[model samples]
Target: MTASVLSRAGADLSTARESLARAAQRVEDLLGALPVPGLRSLEQRDRAAAAHNEVRAHRVDFMATHATEVYDELTGGRTRDLRLDELVEAAAGAFPGLVPTAGQLAVERSRAQADKEGREIDQGIFLRGVLRCDLAGPHLLTAMLRPTTRALLLLPDFQRTGLIEMEAVRLERRDGVARLTMCRQDCLNAEDERQVDDMETAVDLALLDPAVRVGLIRGGEMTHPRYQGRRVFSAGINLKKLSAGEIPLVGFLLRRELGYLHKIRRGLCPREPEQWHAPYLDKPWVGAIDTFAIGGGTQLALLFDHVIAASDAYFSLPAAREGIIPGVANLRFTRIAGARLSRQVILQGRRILATDPEAHLLVDEVVEPAAMDDAVERALTRLDGAAVVANRRMVNFAEESLADFRAYVGEFTVQQALRIYGEDVIDKVDRFSGRSE
Candidate 1:
């Protein structure tokens, strides 16, 4: 990672510079008008610009410094005469990834490639020397297939983001066991649209990896704005970068490899024998979902069996909040909380207070912020042997008795979500965006 080579990669970035700027400007505008009583007068625009530029600056530094190391790995040769243009044509389709074939592949002899070779190749192609760190392995190996640490994780920060700071995942060692902690900032914690996606992808990949055991998540409130100044916009969420980086791949890998979801039997509804008992009667796992467990965050939490929650963790069926409801989340919530709690969860915009006794019904333990981490540790500590498993099975079988309580009469409601993103939503966006109609 030297200064000369990073300069070349930095050159490939002229195209994305402007996009980075607009995204930052829009964020500053929205933060200015937030409903917070004392925040109104704060000039966050400058800070936003600085943060945005910091990421961009890091990109320039990486390009000038790390480019040679990047190129050498991409276009290694017996002759140390490989030029940037030669490397581009040699590894065109896979300039930033790995070799199509395995070790010690031949390099394309020669070609005078164009300056902007981006359109000449597909985005998914591998570069000759990019290293993908193998987390599951005992020994560390770096090659052309993928990147390790900063190269893969911090590349975007170097490219689109303008700053770099410590982003070490907190690992606490207790009784020889290591637990990972995820922290949350009081305000929305995204720099640009690109990093938002990158961080999410990195977290998703890191957590689901079998190498990780218990994941401690504290805050996860990610929001994006379209514009600012006089008008405001909340175009919901932007799943582009996040999705592109393979967020869903984590879930797919979990189910395919782990058989993580254990299906539960629906008990008989006393009167309607064929009808399943309680709403969560026939789900794969048991867990509590609360406090804005909408979007990908909520979806991932459901993948776990025992969910610890805060009363304020408001869970919402955001499908309607968008434009559709595949009834996917319902497939689980209906059974666990039974029909009654499930109905209230979706049909009514309700916040299942974690402090409330009702939260304990869904989760194993419900405690205040200070005690939540302790409760999770206790749950894990006692899980060392077979007794916990035996008790879990016993409790699950007993849960079958609650199937009769799943019934309730009501239609699904979309008013709150609608209000959040309705004409008012568009108006706030357009007004701030200076695109008001």
Candidate 2:
């Protein structure tokens, strides 16, 4: 009932879902086609309405039966808890467009907590509320059921990659603090798929290693002439790849969602039973920003638990100027800087200086360039302790529900995927726009 059988069952479930959707669409079309009241003879209008109602009833019946069948098949009729693989598959069948999101496993646990506190609401009504609250439907459903699904594998050992050796990312640990620096300075640390992969691996290594209690992310020396001899955070996505037509926009978006953004949202750690209640990493993440944190750099800053930025640092998301969407920022920044500020930065390419109040809100502290090391030390001092993880967990619970974050990521991924395939929107910036020989 596992391998091949599970695959076959999944296929059947997809087909059943497609059929149900088509049936539902037909019902909608029939209702839409019905003549307005008084526009047609009463008998004619009533007949059309009757047909619409009949099809709607049939679609509802089919959905109920099909959902049950798929669920039972995935569960092997045992009615017991299913593993993560089974749970994801079952979710796919139950909900169309199911995709992974941030704080994914904590969804059910949050609901349970609310219930215990006498704040629980009806599931259907709660889902409707989430939709009305402007969260993505798939995200809400995934969050609602993610805790029920447990992954079979836990923490895996890390193997250093050749790419890391190439100096794209430098991962090192001193005392209890692990530093994962982006060392690709040629393009101001702009990331292509390869660079992103290296950084992702470095992040996972830093977060998963039990000996390390605090993780620090920063940049290496810049080799670009304009920014030469300076330490810069990042310049966002690699335009060289886009100009050369090497990387597809959809693939780049997926890499960002799964490899980078999701990892930042949900830290890489061995899955433990308590993870549903606190899906973040077991340690705090501190980002050290120097020079500029542009585009993706700014997005990364938003994901970090704490940020230590140099006084000279600035952040910007020029996605709109480049005719591309800053997928994650557009969703996450709203919580950090309200609707108006988020709109200004993402839509209008507004640069946020570290001294600005809006920027200070995101950054934990700002220091002179020479004081960055001391600033990192101060940030870590606050985070490093036996109860650090537990303290952070409490803070997370009080701030916002993981469900909200997961819902936003769901919407971000869908929009990004669509924009990637629409027009030549992604590669709008030409490679030859300005380059030094």
lDDT of 1 by residue, 344-416 (tens): 6666645455565666544566555455556666655544344543454456567433222111100111122
Report, for every candidate in turn, its global Cα lDDT versus the true structure.
Answer: 0.33, 0.60
lDDT (10s digit) by residue, model 2, range 1-437: 78998788678767766765565456446644655332556686667557544644544344344444444544554344443233444544555322222233233223321111111111112222222233233333333232211111112322222112435777777677778788887678887777765765666666666677888889988878888888999888776565444443323544465444555555543347765765556467899999999888998998778898999999999877766677567767887788999888888889999999888767889999999998888888888886867776676556546566556544554345344333344235452333212
Best by TM-score: 2
- What value of lDDT does candidate 2 attain over all alpha carbons? 0.60
RMSD of each: 20.2, 12.9
Error of 2 at 369 (Å): 1.2
- How many clashes (backbone atoms < 3 Å, residues ≥3 apart in a chain or on different chains) does model 2 have? 1
lDDT of 1 at 270: 18
